[model samples]
Target chain A: MAAFIQLFVSGLATGAIYALVAVGFMLLWQTSQTINFAQGEFVMIPAFFVLWAIKILGVGFWPAVGIAVIASLLILGLLFKRAIVDPMLKHGVLPLVISTIALSIFLKEAVKDFYSSQAQPFQAMIPSEDLNLFGAVISSQSIFILLIASGAVLGLNKLLNGTRLGRAMQATAQNPSVARILGIPVERMIMYTFLINALLVALASLMISPIYLAKFTNGDTLGLAAFIAAIVGGFNQVRGAIVGGLILGVIENLAAAYISAQYRGAIPLILLIVVILWRPQGLMGRAEERTV
Target chain B: MMDFLTSRAFKGRVFVLLMVGLIVLPFFLRPFGLLLVAMWMVHAVAALGLNLTLGYAGQISMAQGAFVGIGAYCTGLMTLAGVPYPIAFLCSGALCFAIGWILGYPALRVQHHYLAFVTLAFSTLVFLVMRNEEWLTNGIYGLTDIPRPILFGWNTGKAQDFYFFTLLMTSMLAFCVWWIIRSPWGRAFIALRENPVRALSLGVDTRRYTLMAFAMGSSIGGFAGALYAPLVQFFEPNSFSLTLSLKLLLMVIVGGSGTFFGPFIGAATEVLLPEWLRIAQGYYLIIYAMLVMVLMMFCPTGIIGLGERIISHLRQKKISSERSAQAQAMGQDKVAQTKSDTQGGAGQ
Candidate 1:
């Protein structure tokens, strides 16, 4: 029971991070109809930025995060989205995807060249004490990560549900042409979606960087897992990303503990194949039929 | 000039030029260069497979590297277990063909981006399996000392001999690809890519043809991997990482997807471009990434597409100029007739 609880709590924390990444994917996919393969790079690059600020520039944590978020919004959200994805969108789905993959390669390689290719330590903003809850010893960082991740989700939900800007974004996603006719600035809304995705990924990166070192390859693994999470949950739904992420995280933890550690990595792939085969619409996704 | 260049006779001339280039290429380069050429052929085999799925079928598959790795390991292990190299190679292709066929089931259910992620997940799983199965694979320690291939009782252990052998295989495979692309089944694959719903409505077996393309593509991947083993003599999980798969995709795109010689051009770029850009040291990949982005932006059709565009542009230009000249002559004739009519009226 103790082992189970411990695994569950830790899994929840990891899932929250995965959920954050999945939410980023959902936002971009919803707005642009293109998957930002560089979404993982958004997290990784910002995590490195925070590392640079604190270690090289000798800044405080919050200030470092502030700088990273701004930089990510500018470089990843605006510049990358405008330059790479927007133009590639005109070509076709495959070209758009290939361009994003190219963008990811650029981000990863740029980080490796500019920053240290090796993993760098990053300090979490939260305190480092351990708390015992129902036989599970939870780290302060894990608690903080869970709170912050869930908070971001709730915050995003509120923005999407309760705000004019959120509604405008949704309207744009529903039909850009109609939204344009209705006087909603569809292009700006799409830009805002990219910015929000950047901010959310930066937040997630800051939350998880202390647990795992800021490494170039983190985005590849995390991005892949988050993509799977979004797909298994439902590519079109935000709540599905959260639910799917939690399920994936818990399953991964349980599989690692009970099953052979070697096969732990295969869990998500197995789930993905099963989910895609059994339910292509995903766990909570509405069936959408694309017309010619 | 453009018309002559695009003529069927021009194609034969180009083919003969390529044949001459292939025959004389070994003598012009050192052993290392010869080895690079051999590796290029191996990668071309894999790129051809990718082209079938990504280019011809319009299906996304980032798992080509993993499939290649599976084929390599299977052949390597079988040869170690005393199987003949040729039979082992065939077995490897068959195994990957089966895996690809099974993967096709889920592939049929998903659309473009979904299919991409599925292949990504499948590749990750293949990597995990390759890394974990120490008993069968020797795991991270990797397989070493695999004997070189023997063809017709001649040991292709020498660099030059191996190069020729790989070249022969690449040509045969390339020919097979060309035949397939020209066949009815290939047309069905392209039809699936162009319009799945319409193709299905038109009596094409979308599911079966897709599965066939995926399986055939994967078998080619396996064949490439099998040939790859004898060339390198040792490999590990690192050689078949997702990065390698991405590189294969890069080759296909960079060389121009779907074109007959596109995979070869892509394979050559993958094998040789790095050496040319090696002076940049740490910045080579960054430069390469930027190049790919710029290339995709400006020329999404790859190298072959660029050539086609140039030829077509030239043809259009020539035709438009000739039409203008003819119009000028007609205008002069009308002016002459009008001058005669005006003169006659003045005389009256």
Candidate 2:
């Protein structure tokens, strides 16, 4: 019973992180009608950036977090304009897709080559306190990660439902041509989508800094998991991503705990394939038609 | 037809003869250098095989690396079981073809990026299996102590002899590819890639052709992999990762797809690019990835595309000059037309 409770809580936290990443994936997908394979690379940028800041700039955790988000957005703007938006102005999804894969490789290789050779734990940011719930023992860091992640979802929900710009984002995602006909600046909206996705990645990196040590390949694995969750949730739907993340997290944890750990990653992928074969759309996605 | 044969046919045959003469290169070239070229030729042949699917048929496959791994395993296992070297090599190709045909079933439904995802998954699964399946693969230690591939009554364990063996097999495959492309099956693949609906309307079975493409491409990869096991005398899961698959794609894209000689150029570029950038070793991977991007963007059609553009440009300019000359010498042009009328072949 205690093991079950322990699994449930940790699963929720991990799911929360996936949901956050999925949300970022949806943000870009929604606005531009293309998914960034480099989206997960954005997640690592913040963790590394903040780590760099705390060590070099000597800023406290909160201040370092603020600076990291800012720097990421600035760099994101440049890449969004130059690498992505400009060349892709008149192109199909193919070049953009291939370029993102290239970009992901670049980001990963750069981190591996230039950054610290050894993996570093966020000892400075993560508190070492233990919190016992019922018969299970949990960490303060785990609770904090969960709360912060939940808070982000809540805040994003409010922004999407309440703000004028948020409506413009939705409008652009729903129908780019229609939005253009209706006088919305579609390009600007897409640029903003990239910004928001990068910012979310920064936030996710900061939130998850406690438990998982950030390494060059950490983003690659997390990004793949989140991407799978995003697909399971439905490619373009934000709510679906969040739900998908939690469900996958629980399934993964339980599978790992009960079955073999070697094939832990394979469980969700198998489920995803089966679900896709059944639904052809996702668990929560709109039923899509195939031309063939 | 006779005139056509006498013209470029003479030149083309001469070129082939010259190339065959160059095949005696191992006598003069060092064994190590010959081996290097031999290995590059193997990859070149494999990439050409991939081009039939990825480039010509427009199916982006990521399991080429896995197929190579399978071929290597098959070769190693067969050799270990005391099978003859030639039979082991042929059996590896056949086994990989079967695997590819089975894989092509689900792969027919998926297209573009989604198809890439599934193929990528296959490669990853194969990688994982090779790492964890101790009984079969020895859990990443891989099959070692394999014997070298040899021809009948000929020991090809030496670098020079093995290089010639590899070269002969590669040349034979290259010729086979050329012959296959000249057939209706190759046309079907190209037609399917360019327009599936049109090809279907014209009574082409696209699914079968796609499967054919996958099988053909994968068999070539297997052939190369089979040869590679004995040549290197070692195998590991790390050697057949997704990175190798990506590099194969890069070779096809950078060298030129569709054209016969493009894969050779691409294979050369892929193998030599890093060696050329030896000084900037730390930035080799980043530079390589960036080069692929730039190549994809500017030369999406690859070396053939750029070359075609330049050749067409020159041809167009030359034709225009002749037309202008005719305009300036209208009386002489009229006399030449009468001469053609007297010659009786008016159809041309």
Local accuracy of candidate 1 as per-residue lDDT tens digits, B14-91:
998988898899999999998888898899999999899889988889999999999999989988888899899899
Task: Score candidate 1 by DockQ.
Answer: 0.72
Screening candidate 2 with a backbone cut-off below 3 angstroms (N, C-alpha, C), the clashing residue pairs are none
Kindly report which residue stretches of model 1 are placed more than 4 angstroms away from their true locations once superposed: A54-58, A290-292, B326-348
CA-based DockQ, model 2 = 0.38
Tell me, by DockQ, which candidate is best.
Answer: 1
lDDT (Cα, tens digit) per residue for candidate 2, span B1-348: 333333567659865885676587788877666766777887887798888877778778878888888888889889888999889899989988888887676567657755666676677778878887888888778888888865678888888878878877888888888887879988998998888878889999988988988899899889888888887778888889877786787678667778777788789876755666789787887887787677556656667677666767777787788789878799787888888887766656
Q: Give candidate 1's iRMS in Å, 1 decimal.
A: 1.3
Candidate number with greatest TM-score: 1
CAPRI quality band, candidate 2? acceptable
Interface RMSD of each: 1.3, 2.4
> Which regions of candidate 2 deviate over 4 angstroms?
A54-61, A123-126, B1-32, B313-348
| Tens digit per residue, CA lDDT, model 1, A13-55 | 9988999989888888998887878788888889888877888
